[model samples]
Target: MIEIIAISEAHVESFHRALDTVARERRYLAFLEAPPLAATRSFVLDMIAQRNPQFVALSGGDVVGWCDVQRLSRPIHAHGGILGMGLLQPFRGQGLGTRLIRHTLDAARAAGMSRVELSVHENNANAIALYKKVGFVIEGLQRNANKIDGVYGNVILMALLF
Candidate 1:
């Protein structure tokens, strides 16, 4: 069974592990590669201390996925948040991402966000499908948004409005 809950400092280590696993794959996610564990810990600490919520999917006490909704810090853009998320390889195709995104949207609404936005690599069909299933609409596309291994990729910008 998988449980979804807010991320805490106690979960930092596991979160970093899960992130590392996902980062090794170049098909999805915004990060070109994994950040160091110490950087991951500092990020988790800042999020938890600020009470800015990020949710995790757990199974057997291991972090299998994470959904992060980070509010725009600029005063004018603070009514919305940008989302980023990923699930472990084993958890894909199990509807876990849809579940995590649904929960993340709920959290965004509760946090008084007027909308949530995300960017998916244009080639990631599964992720784009899940985002659309969760009410995100394609807003625009950023050409040559990411370059990895000398290959440039585009990204589709999507958003869910409350």
Candidate 2:
């Protein structure tokens, strides 16, 4: 059974591995690969320090997916956060994304965030649909916002207001 739980320092390494696996796919996240381990560790630690919501999906003690919402640091933008999430290839299409996102968003709401936003590659229909299902609405589109492997792709901006 897979468990969706808040990320702690102990989970950082596994979470980093999962992040690298997804990012290396070069199809979802803006990152072509996960950042250096030290950077990822620092980011996760900062998120924890700031009380931002970050959760991981664990299967057999390994991170298989994650969801997080990072609130803007500026005072005026503190009410808002950027949401990000991903699942390992094998974990997709089984409702795990839905579960992970719901858990993270709930934490965000409880933490007093008023809005959550995300940008998704236009071709990621499943992710777009899942975002919509979770009450996120398309706010705008950026033309040719992402270029990967000599190919350009539009980005769909989405937001959910609490």
Candidate 3:
């Protein structure tokens, strides 16, 4: 069974440790064919300190995924927020991604956010499909938004209005 829970300081070190050698390696490879990611650990830790939510997906007591929800500028964009998430490759295609997004949506609504936005690389068909399944629609495409292996990659900006 999978479970979702709010991350705490107690989980910070392990979370960072798990991600340090794994997520960074994959993302770096995707972006630059590199094997290390600089500053990602510190960034995640700082986000936790700022009380930006870090949710963990667990199965049998092992962390399998995570999603973040943070508030956006107010007044002009009141009740708006941003979301970012990822699941281990082994955990993908099992509907866990949908559950993770739904958890973030619920949390965002409870925190007074009426809209959520996210971006996915155009090359990531699976992620785009999952987001669409959860009601996120592509609002626009940012041209040459990312450079992977010296090639420009586009980003699909998507949003879900609550």
* Of 2 and 3, the candidate ranking higher by TM-score: 2
Model 2 compared with the native: what TM-score? 0.99
Give the alpha carbon lDDT tens digit for every residue of 1-162 in model 3: 889888765565555555554445444223322123345556566667756666888877766777887777567876777787777667888988888888878877777777888888888898889889889999999999887558788888999988
Candidate order, lDDT descending: 2, 1, 3
Between candidates 2 and 3, name the one with more favorable lDDT: 2
Could you estimate the TM-score for every candidate? 0.95, 0.99, 0.80
Ranked by TM-score from best down, the candidates are 2, 1, 3
User: Model 3 Cα displacement at 141 (Å)?
Assistant: 0.4
How high is the CA lDDT of each candidate model? 0.89, 0.97, 0.72
- Model 1 regions lying over 4 Å from their true place: none
Q: Please give, for residues 1-162, the per-residue lDDT of candidate 1 as tens digits.
A: 999999988899999889888888977866756698889999888877755669999999999999988888899999988999999998999999988988878888988999899898999999999989888999999999899889999989999999
lDDT score, candidate 3, position 115: 86
TM-score of 1: 0.95
For each candidate in turn, give its C-alpha RMSD to the true structure in angstroms.
Answer: 1.1, 0.5, 3.5
